[model samples]
Target: MTSRSHSLRDAIEEQIAVGELRPGQHLDETELATRFGVSRTPIREALIQLASMGLVVIRPRRGAVVAEIAPQQLVEMFEVMAELEAMCGRLAARRMFTEEHAQLQAAHDACREAREAVDSDEYYYRNEAFHEQIYAGSHNAFLAEQARNLHRRLRPYRRLQLRVRDRVATSFSEHQEIVDAIVAGDGERTAALLRDHIMIQGQRFADLIASLAHLSNKAA
Candidate 1:
């Protein structure tokens, strides 16, 4: 893809992740092109990319619109994601090198700073980096790739979850435990922590649904 297309994809993806672009909202290529000062080609390309990532849907005649995932489907996806992350953490605990552990600590520290600043966007970015370190540290190329693909697919929902009250702070605290487990080379503990960290359940699941409903109402 051209630089323009790549930038356009990122821009659209961010908007969707941040809830500025609501699920099921139409993505008019011409409007996007005008808004971004680009041609329809790039906008089309961007939407196509988003579709492949499960963030958008291209209808037969309705053109492109943001993808609408059912609540149960979302839950199912998270369940699978939690398992994938747990496996990564388990392997990472046993296989990560000394330098990799240092890098993970650095990422965790960055997340701490973002949490202290109470900047959800910054924390979200750092949080992604922190998890990515574990994925890479797993030393399983295929598993890492699978985790990454699912991570990308769920990016929007994950970002939205941080908007819930006190979630960012709680998430950082959980990360502390996760980091401690991994650094201690406790594979089972790391796996359990990672699974719980990635799973959306109970109040968090309720909050996510509420947030999605609010966004849907606004779109309506």
Candidate 2:
């Protein structure tokens, strides 16, 4: 992808993160083209990139819209995330201890810095890196790639959640828990904890999305 395409993709993703874009809403090519001071060609390419990331859907004649994440789909994503994290933990249990454990530790420390700075986006980014270590630690490149993609698609929603009161402390504690499990080579604890971690995301998505809709109606 060209720099232009990547910039456009990041723009949309940022819009989603800040709730400037909503689900089930079409992205007008002309509008985006005008906003970005680009032609329709790059706008089309950008939408395709977003589509590949599962952040939007471009249908024949129907046009492109921000993807509507259904409750069922969130649950399914959690299920897949759990399985992926479990695979990482199970493999890391056998194949990891020194190198990978250090990587996870470094990420946790970075998260700690972000926590101290009270930077929500940075914390979210570091949290992802902390998990990425475990996925890569599993020594399974394919699994790591898949988990990273899913995690990317979920980034915007996760950022919104980090603003919840005391969320940074909560997440910090969870990271420490996972690091401890990995250090101990306890696959059961790692897997179960990771599974619960992802399930909480699904539940939070459902609750927050519902509340957001209600607030929109009340304000209108």
Q: What does the lDDT come to for candidate 1?
A: 0.93
Candidate 2 C-alpha lDDT tens digits along 1-220: 8889889988987786656777677899999999989988888888999999999899999799988777667667767877888887777766785977788899999999999999977898788788878888888899888888887777656666677667788889887888898899888888888876766454576565664575346545
Worst 10 residues of 2 by lDDT: 211-220
Q: Candidate 1, which ten residues in sequence have the lowest lDDT sum?
A: 211-220
Q: Which residue runs does candidate 1 get wrong by more than 4 Å? A: none
Query: Highest TM-score, which number?
Result: 1
Global lDDT for candidate 2?
Answer: 0.80
Q: How close is candidate 1 to the true structure, as a TM-score?
A: 0.95
